[model samples]
Target: MVSTTTTSTTSSQTTRERVLACMRDFTSYQATRVALYKEFEEL
Candidate 1:
């Protein structure tokens, strides 16, 4: 029973990490795009 509980907790943590990573990646992409656009506008 304890092993099952541990497995479930580990799965949940893994899912959370994946979600956070995706969010970080999306944010980085948006930031880069904005920077590029700003540079182009300045030119």
Candidate 2:
């Protein structure tokens, strides 16, 4: 029972990490896009 609980906890942690990573990537992408747009506007 303890092992099962540990396994579930690990899975949940990994899932949360994956979600954070995806959000970070999405935010970085949006920032880059906005930066490019600003540069284009300046041009």
Candidate 3:
């Protein structure tokens, strides 16, 4: 039972980290997209 608890805690931390990484990636992608749009408008 103790092992199961530990395993679940580890899994939860991993999931949180994965979510944060995804958020960072999405934010960067959005910034890149906006920059591209601005460049197009200036053309």
Q: Which lDDT tens digits does candidate 3 get at residues 1-43?
A: 2445467788888889999999999999999999999999999
Worst 10 residues of 2 by lDDT: 1-10
**Global Cα RMSD, each model:** 5.1, 5.1, 4.9
Measured by TM-score, the strongest candidate is 3
Q: How does each model score on TM-score?
A: 0.74, 0.78, 0.82
Off by over 4 Å in 3: 1-6
- State the C-alpha lDDT per candidate: 0.90, 0.90, 0.90
Please write out the lDDT profile of model 1 over residues 1-43, one tens digit for every residue: 2445467788888889999999999999999999999999999
User: Model 2 over residues 1-43: C-alpha lDDT tens digits?
Assistant: 2445467788888889999999999999999999999999999
State the lDDT at 8 in candidate 2: 75
True lDDT of residue 9, candidate 2: 80
Q: Would you give me the overall lDDT of model 2?
A: 0.90
For residue 1, what is the lDDT in candidate 1? 25
Per-model tally of clashing residue pairs = 0, 0, 0
